[model samples]
Target: MVMLGDILAAARGSAGALERWLAHADPQLAQDTACAAKSVGLGIAGYARMAVADFSRFANEEDWATLVSSLRDSSDPGSTCLAAMVHWRLSAVGCRAHSIPQEAGAKDE
Candidate 1:
């Protein structure tokens, strides 16, 4: 069975590769991978948000902003919520950044 980690890794990698390909004007691969990235990013962000929601101590405005920025920068889809949650957590903690690693093993996904 494929683990969530595996899925996220694949999505992130695909998104990165697609971005690079698009930069080079590789239309075929870029188009295909871009679509895939959006799906994967959304899945990952949603999972993360749901998993961390109850942990109010870690959700704040700064965290949300950072998360939103990351999500916007991400090639994934529907990541805006994830970003908002991050900001909320950070604001709650009165910190500009979270102790958690934003890049945590997952690359793009």
Candidate 2:
């Protein structure tokens, strides 16, 4: 069985690496984690989509912690599953910034 460390390592390497792990992992394990990730991802996506409509709501406190509490409190691979879920959610919502931050004195193009 894939350990939490394995999942975290893959996630740290790249989202693709995690995807590959999911793809090649045991069907039950992959399906369980993926399903959990998808549920969390879509919930987060709802919040993000809402925040896009109302920036103020961006700061809204959600019970997101509870959402992943199960994954976190689970046995081995629990945190790893949470990590993957978070990654998937962020990617799904385009939360990863591809551009570098500009310096204080940087001129705008």
Candidate 3:
């Protein structure tokens, strides 16, 4: 099981490595890698937003779409839903800062 922070860190690191690899790749691979990196960064930022009670009030459909797109590409619906639920819960709490216990268990990456 991986905590959100750990997952975000791994994603960020992978994105960095992928970006470097993209610099020497074919056009298609470069595009794919860039997209992956962007997705990972988005996920990390989304998690941070949730942590800071900023994600719920930040109702940008475009951002949601971006997240959904990334989730689809990554084939990780559970992670997507977890991220979405984090924002949803924040919204439920009126975006107030509070401590929420981890539900069920840590997500597998």
Candidate 4:
């Protein structure tokens, strides 16, 4: 996993990789929001978030849309999820970001 190619292989495609990484990272983060918030900026999660953000150019409309919605979800401070979400937006800032005008699984408007 030292090479860029190795890292690329672990991520699969350009999307859904965050969930996979998180599964390996702190699977409990999804279940423990309080723990996640407290863990933010104090662990690899921060670097992981930054890594996700680095994928902006690789993100599709669907990817961007999910990221935005996740950011708005403050139900639990959005901790670990927020890390990846923020990165996704930042990475997209310089590019022609894509997104769904409607919610996920909703009919397109």
Worst 10 residues of 4 by lDDT: 95-104
- 10 residues in a row with least lDDT, candidate 1: 89-98
Distance from true location, Cα of 89 in model 2, Å:
17
lDDT per residue for candidate 1 within 1-109, as digits (tens), equals: 3333443454455645324423354454344433433444543333333334533454447555666576656564233333344334322433323333233353432
lDDT of each residue in 76-101, candidate 4, tens digit only: 33343444553453344332233311
The TM-score ranking, best first, is 2, 4, 3, 1
Q: Where is model 1 more than 4 Å wrong at Cα?
A: 1-50, 55-58, 78-109
Pairs that collide in candidate 4 are 53-87, 61-99
Q: Which structure is stronger by TM-score: 3 or 4?
A: 4
* Candidate with the larger TM-score of 1 and 3: 3
Alpha-carbon shift of residue 10 in model 4 (angstroms): 25
CA RMSD of all predictions: 12.8, 12.5, 14.0, 13.3
lDDT of 2: 0.42
Q: Estimate each model's TM-score.
A: 0.25, 0.30, 0.26, 0.29
Q: Write the per-residue lDDT of candidate 3 for residues 1-101, one digit (tens) a residue.
A: 43345545544567453234334433454443334334444433344334334454554687567656766666545444445544444333322234232
Could you give me the TM-score of model 1 versus the true structure? 0.25
Off by over 4 Å in 4: 1-25, 28-50, 76-109
Tens-digit lDDT track of model 2 for 9-85: 55655666655554564445455445544544533223223322332222223424543555566565544454444
Error of 4 at 23 (Å): 10
